[model samples]
Target: MRFADIVIPDTSATRGALEVATAYCSPALLNHSVRAYLWAAAYAGMNGIAFDAELLYVSSMLHDIGLVKEFDSHTVPFEEAGGHLAWVFAAGAGWPVERRVRASEVIVRHMWDKVDLAEDPEGHLLELSTALDISGRRPEDFPAGLRAEVLERYPRLGLGEEFIACFRDQAERKPDSLAATFVRGGVADRIRANALDG
Candidate 1:
């Protein structure tokens, strides 16, 4: 249950992000976030795409932090709110402005079903990884047994239902929020019918 003690990349930024994210996010979300990072990184490696692992680690781990009370917002989309929080963390951690900006972009854009790959390959990785996590979309893309290992290491623990509720809450609180848009557009239903239980 102690994730911070787990071994990860030795980079200071990723080391800090893992610690901060593990401490800040709920258990279910922590599991999901780490898996997202793993999936995204794995995809990058498989496809010969170059990426900053530190940025992906920070972006994916903190991507859902906006759903937490400390960063939740009525006016901003949860994605953007999380991006802003990630930006703050990155800045305080002394990330260069460009790097932090890319982190924010990667975090904020995951909500879109499609990402402009040329604009942000990192964002596209997030889209693919989150889509897989949230809905089991394109599960075949990940190598066999990878998902099993991730699940074993970090169980879902009702992450599906929890995220659905968070979206529902966001919908209720702000009809104009992205969650509300998804709800009104029937996307929420599709997301819930996804393979996961959380």
Candidate 2:
């Protein structure tokens, strides 16, 4: 069955951000990032939640950017680092401060165990989308064959293995960072229990 097609927002700024994010992030991270957007946007559509496609796209696309060594920090959490990096990228792309900050909130809070939906619904959708992509939470929610189509366009390419390693690296190097905290706080178990294996 053909699921509703997912539309990508492709303004000039969005295209530029994609290029920079692609240059910095690994293939798996990049694919996962884009898939996160697709999942979030699709979920929003299914749920009838109106959203800012541009902001969501940018935030989701750059969510894992802190993992890139060029922006890596020894002390700061990757989510926050990536948030700051995305903020800068957004600002450079001519986003107003308020909107850029909003986008950064989505990136910064994506790793949170639970995001406050009342405060930022976009971020909330993003958080849920990543959870769906990474761990397959509420598998019944997806439209039939939607996941297969997304994976075909942006294949996981062993993203699960790659991500777990990245999480381990964070746990080892920055024990106090969010990645480290989540990794130590049963993320591995979460991933294992929610394996994406078909």
Candidate 3:
């Protein structure tokens, strides 16, 4: 499935993942998820990184699910909670156990500072993509044309405010989680300063 110049994986698993994201995420978050996939896939294509499109799509779609009230965890960080949810979703999609575990790992690893592309291509792509989307880090790494097309297609839709609120709630509740660390580390300022928002 192609949206604009981006090639989305057209498969039952990918479709199912999109459906799950649409059902659970708010419009702003859902758009952010799709944009995350496009950014990652476009970067991979440009850089000659071999990746599993289906896995990346699925992981991207479900990566921030734990931020939604329906799936939020009290004790664990949102990324870990979302990773568990992705594991179950992959299993229901009839993925093999290894693939299911890989999906979970990819989602969880997106929150890390960096993921080694050689070890886990999907994880690395997702990490870079989400960082770019959320904080506007290294926007120049992607082509100017691709960035323009993606933002025009998906739009930010107040993601900066919505995401900051979600993180604030997470920080207040799970003061020890990574979300708290992000809050303490000035994630809101970073979000507001994102070049993409302009």
Candidate 4:
């Protein structure tokens, strides 16, 4: 599946991930997932970063599954729960144990403040891409043409408002979770103020 110049990995694993994500996540969230992958892939292409597109694609699709009602976990952060789900999904796809672990790790690391590209290229790309999609960080890092094309292809669909609401719910229920920390740090304001929202 190609979007603009980005070639999304077309594999059983990628297809299954997309199906599961589309079945569970809201349209806004689903689009966010796809955009996350595109952003990461584009950045990697420009920066000469080597990555496993199938792994990245699968991880990107399932990275936010925990936010949805079907997969939300009461005992852990959404990212952690999502990671577990990704692990199962990867196993179902016949991924090796190491590859499965890598998928889980990439999903879990997307919420980190930073991921060292040298340590985990895919994790670093995902972290940067999710940050860009969610909080509109480093809009200048991507070319204007690429940004416009991606946005046009997958509109935000009010992700700013929906994501803030989801985080607020997570914060209220899991006060010790990263979602709580994000709410405490005024992520709502950042989402709303994102230049990309306009």
Clash list (residue pairs), candidate 2:
none
Residues 1-198, candidate 1: write the lDDT tens digits: 123322345577777778878887899988999889888877777777777777888888889888888889878888989999888889988988988899999998998879987788889999899988886788777765666667778889888778888888999998887678877777666666765443
- In candidate 3, which residue pairs get closer than 3 Å at backbone N, Cα or C atoms, i.e. clash? none
lDDT accuracy of residue 145 in candidate 2: 85
Ranking by lDDT: 4, 3, 2, 1
> Could you tell which candidate, 2 or 4, scores higher by lDDT?
4
Model 2, residue 184: what's the lDDT? 70
How does each model score on TM-score? Answer: 0.89, 0.92, 0.96, 0.97
Question: lDDT tens string, model 4, 1-198?
Answer: 124668689999999999999999999999999999999999998888999999999999999999999999999999999999999999999999999999999999999999999999999999999999999999988988888889999999999999999999999999999889999999999999987888
lDDT per model vs. reference: 0.81, 0.82, 0.93, 0.94
What TM value does model 4 have?
0.97
lDDT of 3 at 142: 81
- Candidates sorted by TM-score, descending order? 4, 3, 2, 1
**Could you tell me which 10 consecutive residues in candidate 1 have the lowest summed lDDT?**
1-10
- What candidate 3 gets wrong by more than 4 Å, as runs, is 1-5
Q: What is the lDDT of residue 16 in candidate 1?
A: 79
Q: What's the lDDT of the predicted structure labeled candidate 4?
A: 0.94
Q: After superposition, how far is residue 180 of candidate 2 from its true place, in Å?
A: 1.9
Write model 3 residue lDDT over 88-197, tens digit each, in one string.
Answer: 99889999999999999999999898999999999999999999999999999887777887889899999999999999999999999888988999999999999999
The superposed Cα distance between candidate 3 and the true structure at residue 67, in angstroms, equals 0.5
